[model samples]
Target: MPQLKGIKILLVDDEPNILRFLEIGLQNEGFEVLTAQDGLSAITLVKQFQPHIVILDVMMPGMDGFEICRMLKKTENLAVIMLTAKEEVEDRVKGLNLGADDYMVKPFSFDELLARIHARIRNHFPNMWGEVVAGPFRIDDRRKEISYEDKVLELSPTEYELLKFMAINNGLVLSKAMILDKVWGYDFNGEENIVEVYIRSLREKLNDREHRLIRTLRGSGYRIDVQ
Candidate 1:
């Protein structure tokens, strides 16, 4: 339902019917859509179009969706959604671990796919302006940067989202479900352990010998309290 006008989306699928279907659906929503039938063409369109979002099919003939997702993630602020025919948990997790923003299995509803695309764009580029501070940590929503004291942390897209959510809530104790919903969006059908994976990744990047930024509560979830 978000205003998608001028938002470019690249659809990469070998099936011409699928590509046409999605292109029409997205175009109807006021998005500028580009189509690619293979990984090589996807990469070329990516460089040329520099789309804000990409809907990629997993099982292409050469250069699978996973490889393309990994490559495209190197771009600073691009969002990716992987589409797979298989409903395996391993496939979903692998895609997410490889930095895909979200994934959908085949036969997914057009409405749901549109919602996911909107959610990804919304989460990545929040409307908030200026910086938020919690003790020694500062999160600049406009800049998409997080700093501890005077040093900035090099965090991935997922890591930055998780950390920013916690930082916004500050000392509040956030349940795993709440964090998952806020950070990963309601479309994420993966296990709660995905939250743990991102938390561990954030902890590693926020490693400070004297101060702990994220605190875990037994039987509860996590809280960010900078001292």
Candidate 2:
């Protein structure tokens, strides 16, 4: 079986070589992928392919990376991971501040990227029907309560929603928009930053338990797969 199976990944970049390299790497890890060469194409693929995650490069011609991400978040159901060629701290902070689940600078190890992806997956999908039990991490969706070693976990409403959805999806890649639609409901009028804020809340609650689940797929959406 594929190591990271059952997730549809959308890879966007203006460069053919970069697209090919990322595609091969993701495919080798057992992912189903689609590619787009520019901003317009990326938007089309995001809507049509409905990838679980997006691997977006920030330097594409015409639209550019920030604009694409802004567009995706504006749509109200897209989850995005950004890729940068530079290690500018502002860029990284900006991506996270904009509701991007994760961002990585180029020349980084593929393994590091994979690890982040896997962590996002597991964090986002830990159970089914809003519940899962792995030792002390007992999460019950019906009550929206998580407990470690039988101790009750105090989680915010947004955090609860994140955990609930992740548990239900198990090993599926859930785009940011998908998460927003399901968790915040279709009527939520808040900005996309809401998603990132909730994710951080959830992460803080989970603490060191964070791992390969609920991972980010750069330029794509989020996933709930175990490494």
Candidate 3:
């Protein structure tokens, strides 16, 4: 397995024993971990820590996980996994509808939770993973290589960065200025049309001649939708 050393995780649960257990276990697994016993603390820590993933408990005394999850989704790009004692399908559906990336019932297997954590972060926080998976695109940071639909792409350093940026932010529409600042440097003084050039190159390589995978939003910049 790849190392998840630098990833930040926030665990929110009112139970002291559960929080202590998870905090210890996750730290041992190399994740930078934090624990919040209530929704208010969790929200505060989220702003301060900006963790890549949040494991939230559903039944706190006030501002339950569903409400916290709702608020978390509105302003954050992080992944949320709901932990609840309830086993009802409706509860799970409600959590999912509220934008939780995953749900786990209490007394769950720790190994399974860890696996789900890996999966959720890999899919949502691609840049933090050694090997990133976004839809059909796979990026191996160690090898500095990427493949689309299992076919390897021959890309320049610039193109690789551009594609990686867009893939990680899969469904979000990005403006030209945003892409330029990210792929190029924040201080890049180059023309924005350079983005157009690289996009064309990448499209040709992906066989996206009709621009289905990466769509141009006309006035807006671009968005990648491999799904």
TM-score attained by model 2: 0.54
By TM-score rank, best first, the candidates go 3, 1, 2
Stretches of candidate 2 off by over 4 Å are 76-78, 125-227
What is candidate 3's lDDT per residue for 29-120, written digit by digit as tens? 67899999999999999999999999999999989999999999999999999999999999999999999999999999877788789889
The candidate that achieves the highest lDDT relative to the unseen native structure: 3
lDDT of 1 by residue, 100-203 (tens): 99999999998779768867776875552246556666777677888878689998888888887787566668899999899999898999999888888777
TM-score of each: 0.56, 0.54, 0.59
Candidate 1's TM-score: 0.56
**Candidate with more favorable, higher lDDT: 2 or 3:** 3
Q: Count the backbone clashes (under 3 Å) in each candidate.
A: 0, 36, 0
How many backbone clashes are present in model 3?
A: 0
Given candidate 1, what's the lDDT at residue 147?
A: 89
Q: Candidate 3's C-alpha lDDT?
A: 0.90
lDDT values for all models = 0.82, 0.72, 0.90
